[model samples]
Target chain A: MPLDAMTDVSDEALLVLFANGDQMAARALTLRFTPKVMAHAYRLLGNHAEAEDVTQESMLRLWKIAPDWRQGEAKISTWLYRVVANLCTDRLRRKPGLALDAVPEPEDNAPGVTERIQDHTREVALQKALNQLPERQRQAVVLRHIEGLTNPEIAAIMEISTEAVESLTARGKRTLAAKLAGQRNELGYSDD
Target chain B: MNWGIAMTERKFDPVDLDHLFARVREHPAQPSADLMKRVLTDAYDAQAAVTPVTAPQLPGAPWLLQVFRELGGWPSMAGLTTAALVGVWLGISPPDGLVATADSFFGTDDDAYLIDVAPEATFEIAEGFLQ
Candidate 1:
């Protein structure tokens, strides 16, 4: 199938196609998911290199599980999110006390120099604050705030109740606010 | 005016977390082409493992077994099993036409062509020719 034609197909169906030896399905899946997985892993791990590793490994696992993938039982993104989260957790556990300051500034040139600097600082501050959050809370916050998933989706990925998801994200935001509160001026956020 | 003090005092209003962290989405880390190639190769490998391969042809297999294998090994076995069951059922209750059909198709009576050649008749013919 053409790439555009496969765009409308569900991830589960694409996986089934992939298992059945359709190379186009594999291409479509990789094109659709690698970036999201990488971003999720990056936010959770706070290191680009580790995030890339997690993304590749998570995707490899996804490929391996494609044959036995049960459609309609679970969404592909949900499964990948769980895998990336667990993988990131393992990496974090192995090397605890990861330094957030080492995160390289993202490359962007569309915005003005001043705006880019402010955005980079805000992002760095957010990453630092997110690192301060407890594991589950951090996962919830990133999935909810940064990844822009719904509370129910976050609950599914985190394997927790919707209420629990809400509470975690709420607490996470509060903690981030508190952590970055002192740097408001430095982050370019002026007082009202 | 300090936000951290407000949060400590339980008086801090919830900030717009979505808008605050939106920059992260704008500049996500991307997988390099090398990583994409590696992933696709792995996918192809897994796909190969999942797909069923054709069984290699066994040289000098019996025709019957070959027929069965062609129909898919299991289906061929099933067909043979059904045939055996029907044969057993016929043995238990022979049909009227079955006897006639068997006699016409299998009986050797009045079929001289199927009988063995007489050795005496061949000898007599050879002796007459020699004389």
Candidate 2:
């Protein structure tokens, strides 16, 4: 089938097509999920280079499992999220050091310079605060607040109960608030 | 109690985190094109490994042989078994001894019935017998 026609196909159907050796399915799947997987990994690991590696490995695993992939049993995105999260966690476990250079580089455009700098500063501060959190809390916070996933989805990704997810997010948000409270003025928020 | 409840409600709206959420949400880190290329290559390789290739059917004799091969080879076990049974039946139920009968009728040697007869009469007798 033509690539244009494949746009509306579901991921489950695409995987079945891929298993049947359709190149278009592979292209569609890669285009559909690589960015999400990369972003999810990047949030968990905080390093573009490492996150990219994780994305590649995760995609490779996805490709290998396409032949045996069960349609409708689990959503492809959810499964990719779980793979990325576990891979990031494993890397974090092996070496407790997160590279300082993992902070995103600032853009060099001369326009809107101050706003961009401010945004970058806020991002760095948020990342720093997130890094200080326990791994599980960080995962929950990033998935829920940053990725905008629902509590149940976060729970499913973390393999924890929904109540546990709620607890972690509550605790995580409180800690994040306390940590960034002193920077409120610097971050340009109006005084309470 | 009213004052305490009001304080709790106010505390819920403390810090403005819209900026933080917006920045992270807006600028999710992206994988480079090179990374995507690598992934696609891997996908192609994986797909190639999975799908089976079927050979085209050969023409004429080869095609016929292939058909037989798929049917578990020609002259099957059942056919061979039937042929063997026919052979065994023929051996067990032998026909009467045709060679002995022929010798008695024509006289094999010395005391041959046609020995005393003239050649022409013998020929006549043999011709009559045949008729």
Candidate 3:
């Protein structure tokens, strides 16, 4: 089947196609997932280069398991999220001192408008604050707030109860709010 | 601009938290081309690794079994076996006219026992031993 027609195909269906040796399915899955997984990794690890490595490793694992992927067992994106989170944890463990300092600075040229610069600053600030959180709290908060994933989905990715996810996110938010409270005026939130 | 010490104790409701979440969501990091390239390369490599390979033809099997395979496996071999048996049966109990035709083509059937051939010559050779 043509690649264009694959837009509506489910990830599981595309995986089936890939197991059957459809290279186009591989390309489709790659295009569909890389950005989301990479971004998720970036949020978890607070480093762009490490995020890229984790993203590639996570994707490679998906490809390796395609042939044996049992239908209805797990959503592909959920599995990828879990893998990215775990890989990020491993990377973070290997370099304990690596923190928000390693996170890339927000690019200044692309969002040329004045308001967007503030938004970028806010995002960069939020990421730095997130890095200060406990690993589980950071994962829960990013999956819940930043990624906009549901509590149940975050639970599945974190292998925790939904109630636990809620607790983590709530605490994470309070801490984050406290961290950002002092800078609200400087980040242009006082005018809001 | 610190909103005094009260800012330290303020609670951010869901509506307020949305402000921070929105910034990260709206400005998500994109996967670089280099990362995409590495992922694609891994995908192709992994696909090749997991693909099933046909097992090599079974070697060191008995010759008869191999011949059985060469003769189109079991079904066709059964047919060939039946045909061979029928040929043997036909040759053994041929039709009445087939014997005459075969005799005419390949001379008469002088089938005889060893004792019947040259009995007098055998008796003359034994006469000297009796004397």
Candidate 4:
């Protein structure tokens, strides 16, 4: 399949094509999925370099499994989510007690614009709070709240029941709320 | 009376948690294009590493296994070799001829002995033992 033509095909079909040694299909799958996986990794890991690594690793796993890729068993994006999540969790475990606050700021080009200033503050606080969450809770919260995955989709990704996903997300939200409660006002969100 | 009772009632409603998380939904951080490019490049490279090299054969089947099957199954070849060895052994030494040689060395009678004994068990016997 041509890369351009793959746009019309479903991810599952593209993967099957990829398994058949279609380079265009491989490229298309990469282009289609890399950004989403990178964003998920960045939110989870809080570093661009690490996120890139995780994205690559996750997509490589997808390629490796393409031969046995069972259609309709699970969505490709959902599987990527789980792979990236596991990679992030592995990175976290390997470096226990490292704080997200310790992340070095990217070099600023100039004096902050209003939007930049607001974004920087929120990003810092959010990353810090996310760092404080337990691994599973962090994964659940990121998938559900940040990545906008539904409970059932997250359940499929995490290999858990929907009820378990609900419970995990609820707990994750509560934990995030408690962690960020003090900074809510600082973040400029007035609690009603 | 119902209206008066309803007017005094106060109800507690569950908080709208979605409203609290509303900010996060809109605050998605966009990674730089360069970062995305690097990541995608790495993914492409990794995918290349994982994607099986195409042999001039069917996809999804291991090339080595296919090769093995194409060149005769191992067990069948072993069975053929074993059958050939047994045939050679049987041809070299026929089973029925071996049994006949054993019967001639001792005498065909029910209580026959290989040695011929005189009435008083005197002289030696070595003549034509096969008879």
Candidate 5:
């Protein structure tokens, strides 16, 4: 199948293609999921290299599970979120390190307005504050805030109740508020 | 009650985090080409692992032989040939041997010959009707 031919195909359907050994499905899925997976892993691990490794490993698991993946039971992205979160949790447990030292670089160096530069600054500060949070808190906050997932979705990914998700995110936001209190003025936020 | 801290917490609605979240969400971390290549390679490897391999067709074999090969191969063909040989043997063998086998199946030798679908009177009735 042509690579673009799968553009309209659902992720679950694409996995079916992957199960059938269709290389096009592999390419299409990789192209589709890699960026989000990479960004997500980066947000969790905060190390580009480790995130890359996690992204690759997560995708490897996905490919391997294609044969037995039960369609309609779960969304591919949701399953991926669970896998990525679990993998990140394992790595963090294995070696405890703050993401402060490894703030991500801008994805590109495109010349743009000064606003983007400020946005980058704010992003770095946010990541630093997020890194200071407990892992569960950070995962919840990132999923709820950065990834824009709903509480219910985060609950599914984190394997927790929605109430738990709400608590984690609320506490996470409070801690982030404390950490980001000073940077607010510099990050272009004004009471006015 | 620490109403002071509670009051402080209530007042501190989180600062506008939308900007920060937007920056990260908008620019997804780019995956390196090497990583992409490795991922696709793994996908292909897993695909190869799961896909069943079919036996290659034997070269220069007749279709009939191939059909037989598919139908349980040599053992089944041997059994079928043995059965056909037995049938041919029974068909061409002398009537005496067939009668003996029939007698064994029925009862005594006379009983094998005596067993009939209908009496001779039935054949006469059919002949008279035709006339």
Candidate 6:
């Protein structure tokens, strides 16, 4: 079957096939999950190159454990999400001077004001504000809001309780709101 | 306490905050193609290394048959085990046939025969004695 067609295949089945040494299954899984991981990493690290590295390393770890992957214990994407999050944290720690304010713009020629001023700008501003948060809070917020994960899932990914995830996200969002409040009007969010 | 509760009951509603924050989630950036390729390659390489080596297809033998062929055939192990058991049995119990052969080759008076034998003893004498 074509690699792209494997998108409909369940992660559990791909994992089983990967465990059995099916290269196609491995490729299928990599193609399926890499984008999500890379997007998460980029949001967390704010550096496309570093995010790419983290994504690669995270996927490599996934592949390395494929043979021993146990189904029903946890979702594969969840495992990958956690791994990428941890890797981004490690990268952040290694370079304390790396500021979150330095997120790169897309390479495409300068987008028109409408394109530039779209919802993505808000997302970038939110990501920057999120980066200013403590690591746990940032992770909690990213996992909960950006990733659209349930509180329980976020808790599991962060290795914390659901309550903790909720608290962290709440605090993180409050901090983000305060930080981004100045940009709200510029980002087209002002009620006036 | 009731007065304090009434005083503290009023706070900024979080719904406004939720509404404002809702736009923050709208446009997540897509991963670049280069990044995607790197991740997929890494995952593929890792899976290749850790995946178990199952039997491969061959023209002459199916996977199972190839496995059996690699295992040196069933009869080989049985033959080796039988040989080992026979060797153990022979080691514990000396072979009567060998003992009989040795006895026939060297008769009861072999000691006297050795004593009488000399470097100069002729082949003729030995043949005559045997006859």
Model 3: pairs clashing at backbone N, Cα or C within 3 Å: none
- Candidate 2: the clashing residue pairs are none
Estimated TM-score for each candidate: 0.76, 0.72, 0.70, 0.61, 0.72, 0.68
Model 5 pairs whose backbones collide = none
What order do candidates take by TM-score, descending? 1, 2, 5, 3, 6, 4
Model 3 regions more than 4 Å off = A1-4, A99-112, B1-10, B13-16, B52-131
Model 1 stretches with alpha carbons more than 4 Å out: A1-5, A101-111, B1-17, B55-74, B77-97, B100-131
Docking class of 4: incorrect
What would the per-residue lDDT of candidate 6 be over residues A135-177, giving only the tens digit for each residue? 8898888878777889989988888899989899988877777
lDDT per residue as tens, model 4, A1-192: 444557888999988887776767767887788778877887788776777778767877887788888889889998898888889989888977544535444456756665555555666777777778888888888888878888988889999999988898888777666666677667665534
**Best prediction by lDDT:** 5
Residue by residue across B4-113, what tens digits does model 2's lDDT show? Answer: 88776446535556558777899888889999899999999999898977556667678786766676654575687788998888678756885467668976776675
Interface RMSD of 4: 4.4
Sort the predicted structures by DockQ, highest score first.
Answer: 5, 2, 1, 3, 6, 4
Error of 2 at A16 (Å): 0.6
Residue-by-residue lDDT tens digits, candidate 5, A1-192: 565568888999999998998988989999899888988998888778888989999999999899999978988999998899889889888878734444544556667746776787887788778877999999999999888999999998888999999999999988888889887788887775
Assess candidate 5 and give its lDDT: 0.84
Where is the poorest 10-residue window by lDDT in model 6 chain B? B7-16
Q: Of 5 and 6, which scores higher on lDDT?
A: 5
Leading candidate by TM-score: 1
Candidate 5: which stretches are off by over 4 Å? A98-113, B1-11, B56-131
Chain B TM-score of model 2, please?
0.34
What stretches of model 6 exceed 4 Å from their correct place?
Answer: A99-112, A115-120, B1-26, B51-131
Better candidate number, 2 or 6, judged by DockQ? 2
Q: CAPRI verdict on model 2?
A: acceptable
Candidate 1 structure quality by residue, lDDT tens digits, A1-192: 455368888888899899899989989998899989988888898887888889989999999888888878879999999999899989899999765646556456655777877777778788878887899999998988888899988888888899999999889888888887777678876555
Task: Give the runs in model 4 whose Cα sits over 4 Å from its true position.
Answer: A1-5, A99-112, A190-192, B1-131
